[model samples]
Target: MEPDRDSFTSLEPGGDNAIAVTLGILGDEWNLWILRHAVEGAKRYGDWMREGAISNSVLSARLGALTDKGLFDRVQYAHRPDRYEYVLTRRGADIWTVLLTMWAWEQTWAPPATPPLPRMRHIGCGEFFSPATTCGECGAGVEAHDVVAELGPSGAWPRSVPASITRRRSAGAKQPSQVIPHTMELIGDRWSAAILGALFLGARRFGEFSERTSAPPTMVADRLARFVRLGAIDTEPNPDRPDWVSYRLTPKGVAFFPVVVFMITWGQRWFRAPEGPALIFTHRGTGHEFRPRLACDRCGEELTASAVSIEPVAD
Candidate 1:
């Protein structure tokens, strides 16, 4: 019998252990907060609470949830008190690249003066770092608009397309969650994109996000929640205001910096004003402008959206 369409299928069926870690972790606000704290070295409960303004109940619940998911380990740090601290497991640390990318993105697009708390650096290079997205082949910069969608060689497609794209093109309906459709769904919405941009710029407060985007407070709240669920943003308690809350990017959220940086760089180059962008990024070490280009790391070839192919890895 044919399997149900909604049932999950592995990219590699029983070949390698490719767990659906993305879908599993991205489900709620607290989980995201736990991750953010873990990234910030908030292993102990007291340290986490001190680092952000999360409520005790919420923090407890999120810690438990993360521990349950195997992203964090609750190890006993105190003997008499029988206290535990949360630490990132290997699976958790693997997502750090994503966080660094997100931080780099915010530094570029959002307001430049007020950066997010706790900046990132490349430990290996010992320099304050901004992540760059070069082409996997060419190492040159590419923009989102420069990429166009086409049918894959395998003839696979996402299950659905946004209404706006469909209206723009007189093509037949396609499956949703296919590559192009999924891409649009991920980044097409202005509010969603704006929220991401703001987060990159260090606007974690509701009012700050709303002010930055000129979006409704309610909309910002909803989007923040959604981002939290997507493991893109973490919701935490406000440090100064006990009843209030704040948000920050998780490691997964930070990893998205490359995507944001690429898109914004593309926008600036293709859509900037005659006077140039309201903001620009510079390489801290070289004192040169950082205009990212996407090229393949191995082949040094520019990868257009159409030029790339996604093959399911063997399990």
Candidate 2:
């Protein structure tokens, strides 16, 4: 079914503008998990339960919320009592790139939790390429050290001081600050990242997450609960199965895209698997890897951290 774009993307203004707009729709942990499943084929409640292992009450709430938001079409698959299956609408499918970016980020910076992640064979070139992002405009490779940021008219920082930034750029430490960002403290653990990445890659069932992440069931359940509480994910009831539920992403949850893409480009620039890059993602038609470039919307010059300045909005 065609999804109403307005339903999912209607933005609200508040603190930090875009981030705030994204946060209103975003929930913590399990929301993205559910959407990941929907993309992969977990249409019925039982399919979700068996896969995500979410509680009954929580699942019901999430399903209703997602349907209301128009991310999923609650299509009636059965007639006896009008059984329904939660299917992904166009807006929902758009989240796949966010998830895909995470998967690539995980493979590159998140460390080797398991032996070679599922290989991504580029259909055009028939070689493994890690998923990557390029500038939507100029198509230059984006890197963390190269970009500068400042508030747009709609954005305001809470403080009026110069932003001080510090980072350790090493990928070798088990708990290296470079590979793991503060944002990932909750979901950064390999297991949670793997689970989220799996969902984005279409592994919905709990068993599938386990297999994909090579984690035990207990670990999967633990991370799922953590994600749900953090408001990064949500759940819903699956109608066709009657006994199961579904999981889906909130808009706020989908807002994690920029972070994922940033990390992916960072990984691409810095860390590489000992054997080599595990996978590569290329354009379907062009077969060229994503080369992200960042330039000013107006002047169109390449962005550089040294050349940029940021100041808090005066209160």
Candidate 3:
């Protein structure tokens, strides 16, 4: 169901905070690509061009735009040659978590082979990693059907009922709740998901992101701004050039990488492409692929969307 835009309130009542800002920054494909490259250690424009073949104008614009949004730091590596490099800030590094999650999804659901890519394994145990949803608190596995979606404090709720619901009522169907909230809303857009995929592959510059996703510049800029506001990235001053800047993910942002890994896994399993995954992650210790699963830290149980419920604390 569509969210109630009227009732939804911003996490920051008056304005966007770090989280909102970061979200705005990473929301776009170009910005995301810039982040991706930074993650992969792309510092020079030449490096970005060689990797992605993006237009110079588009790349320049995206870099400048990301700098303005605080996602990138530009530093002059050579004054005489007028060469510069980009780097990620603490904030930018944080977004890796999100990228990891998306990668996991793509690997599982969108496999290049009919039998699917080789199974991911735990680096420590040498056990094949299986997809499981567990509770965040209890560590118990949860299923999609076990949890119910509800409107959160930050979301807009309907001031009035939608015409479709009202019409359904007229036809004798039960009127659903006035509010509905789900985790999917946090990362629902196809573009957003795809952008996260590119980031997982280490595309940190606009050109690289565009090359991977083929997204438009304007849209990429907008999304990158969202990610900035969301606190997913940090802009830093280039050490060599005080006037230039580079972008990176924050710790919080990096934590979201697991979400990307999960997404890739899902995509590979469910949505195969003519070609295989651009890249695959293997367990460094186990010599096996890593398939991430979400589980509750407290109980080690898998967490599913339907398995948990939230209640507001008393004021």
Candidate achieving the largest TM-score:
2
Query: Could you give candidate 2's per-residue lDDT for residues 1-315 as a string of tens digits?
Result: 433643433222332232222222232335555765666667888877885347667567777777765668788889978888888766565555544454455555445533233334343343444444345444654443233332234333221111211222257522311122324533444555556645544555556666656667898888877767756568777665657655555443544445544433333233222322322334334445544543433344444422333221232
The backbone clash count of each candidate, in order, is: 43, 44, 146
Misplaced by over 4 Å in model 3 are 1-13, 16-23, 111-154, 157-315
Model 3 Cα lDDT, one tens digit per residue, 1-315:
221222221222423222223334443445555565566677788867774546677678777766554446677889776888876644444454444344344444333432222233333333444444443333344442233222223212111011111011236432211111111222435344445545544556665556655567776666566667656656677676677554566554554555544443433332222233323545433444445456433444454423323122232
**Candidate 1 lDDT tens digits, 10-65:** 23222211111232333233454456556656688787666545678767866775
Which ten residues in a row are the worst by lDDT in model 1? 154-163
lDDT of 1: 0.48
lDDT of 3 at 119: 37
Q: How much is the lDDT of residue 179 in candidate 1? A: 19
Question: Residue 118's C-alpha lDDT in candidate 3?
Answer: 29
> Candidate 2 regions off by >4 Å?
1-3, 6-8, 12-16, 24-27, 111-119, 157-315
TM-score of each: 0.42, 0.47, 0.40
